[model samples]
Target: MGRLQRLSSNACQRLARRAAPQPIIRRRVTYQVAGRDFLVISGYEPDGQRIFYLKKLVRPSLQAGFEFVYPANRRERYDRDVEAISRSLSLVDP
Candidate 1:
């Protein structure tokens, strides 16, 4: 929940587990695009399955795509891009 900090290759692999209770994030996928880094974390609970994704868009040219599912009973409710990145990175709206 804290800012994910700058993660190394090993750190990214380590996050691929259940670390919290709410939202119950259980899986993480990480890769690089252009020059920046991206990460996706998905999980499921009794209510439904949710996916929270994060991307560090270091390169402004790459297309950004991510999704944030919060206790989502339906997948279509959440946006599939910037909002997802913000949610995963804990970015707050001003």
Candidate 2:
């Protein structure tokens, strides 16, 4: 399961300090292509409702986050598909 990324260095320290008792849930899968690492993560509620998807380049802080859901049983395949999609992405000019 994935854990929340620290929004900032101080947020990390505050999280480590344990202010909230609610259970946070997430799942993460990471893959590397070329020399960069990318993360695929899903956040959910305790009752199993999805909240968002996050894909980020681990080193450069490039990221995109949004709501998306897939059947729990098919996540592995979908992650691979996402990897393929991500791998093909490019910054384009109009």
Candidate 3:
């Protein structure tokens, strides 16, 4: 499968695993950053916490990403930092 397809499939698998414990409120979003497209899966818990799993295919053979877990009630405080970190993603030669 292609990168985007694979990423989506993996994200769905992850969501299933997470859902086994409790129903997780989540959204699958796409963002354009540093001239690349990123797939982000954000999951929210009933207890006022959240998790973000961001991933992008940096190259045909590589993937790049990051994750963040924070209190949903304090999202305003974490939004800027999350945006900064997401914007910092870059394609590097290996």
The best candidate in terms of lDDT? 3
Per-residue alpha-carbon lDDT of candidate 2 for residues 14-90, written as tens digits (9 for 90 to 100): 88779667575545433223335555555543445333345554445444333355555666767676556666655
lDDT ranking, best first: 3, 2, 1
User: Stretches of candidate 2 above 4 Å error?
Assistant: 1-41, 49-52, 56-68
Q: What is the TM-score of each candidate against the true structure?
A: 0.28, 0.35, 0.52
- Which 10-residue window of candidate 3 scores lowest in summed lDDT? 28-37
Per-residue CA lDDT of model 3 for 1-94, tens digit only, reads 6565445888899988987887655553433344354466555544545645454646677778888777777788887888798689876768
Model 3 stretches astray by more than 4 angstroms? 1-37, 46-48, 51-53
Q: How many backbone clashes are present in model 3?
A: 0
Error of 1 at 50 (Å): 1.3
- The TM-score-based order of candidates, best leading, equals 3, 2, 1
Estimate every model's Cα lDDT from 0 to 1.
0.48, 0.53, 0.65
State the local distance difference test value for candidate 1: 0.48
| Residues 1-94 of candidate 1: C-alpha lDDT, one tens digit per residue | 7675788888776776545444653454432234334444455444345544444433334445444445445546654553544655532333
lDDT measured at residue 27 in model 2 versus the true structure, 0 to 100:
51
Q: Which is superior by TM-score, 1 or 3?
A: 3
User: By the lDDT metric, which is better: model 2 or model 3?
Assistant: 3
Cα RMSD for predicted model 3: 15.1
